[model samples]
Target: MSHPILTEKTVLLNANVKNKEEAVRLAGQLLVDQGCVEPSYIDRMLEREQSLSTYIGNSVAIPHGTEKGKKNILRSGISILQIPGGVDFGDGQMAKILIGIAGKGNEHMEILSKIALVCAEEENVSKMIHARSKGELFSLFDGVN
Candidate 1:
């Protein structure tokens, strides 16, 4: 069986998280639940955050595993977490949208670029943050990449 990169089941809306770590865990958990990656991948995601912030500005953050975490990836997957309340990503950067990614092989680069493009627009980020339903959020990501 094959899974789509972004599924409704993986898109969480109105998530309330205390901090970036908790946010990353929620996003990573979605990918794991979807059979996209191993359980250990979440740790690497945290490690990556510690090394460098994934907060890309415009109220968006993209969290992905380190190079070593690649081994834990079962397939390419993207998880979206809509945090309307927002979480502090350190350095005064509060991210309202958290995108967790697990890509197989060289697919991560492509996924990153596509996500970057979508997130670059402030309007799109606002739409994602305020999306009332999973379907609404899914529509924002439709045809992405």
Candidate 2:
């Protein structure tokens, strides 16, 4: 199978998710819509979250993992989710946006580094949190190339 990058996947616009659970579900839905993953992928992702928190810091969380080469066989998904009340990130920080990425083998670190670079910029994070549509969010990565 051909493993593509995050840009090749479709994004979910106007994801009105309030918390981490809903955010993960929305991302999984996006993967499903893009024919990247199965419907059960969301449930598995949630289970992983329950096992351990994916939040890193600075209002960012990357809830990610790989399955038995089944549902989650995509590259990555940069889901710009808005946590209405914020979710505890285990470091006195509340996650405002989630960038859910799913890939294979050693490709995770590179994509994760890209995500980290994007999150390191406060301006970028702000723009993502306030993004009104998927088109706008996709535009954020325009210069990332």
**Considering every candidate listed, which one attains the maximal lDDT?**
1
RMSD of each: 1.0, 3.4
Residue 116's C-alpha lDDT in candidate 1?
89
Model 2 residue runs over 4 Å out of place are: 1-4, 7-9, 66-71, 74-78, 82-92, 143-145
Pairs with steric clashes in candidate 2: none
lDDT of each: 0.93, 0.65
Off by over 4 Å in 1: none
Per-residue lDDT for 16-78 in model 2, tens only? 655668777776666667665667767777877888788877677887654543345554444
lDDT of 2 at 140: 66
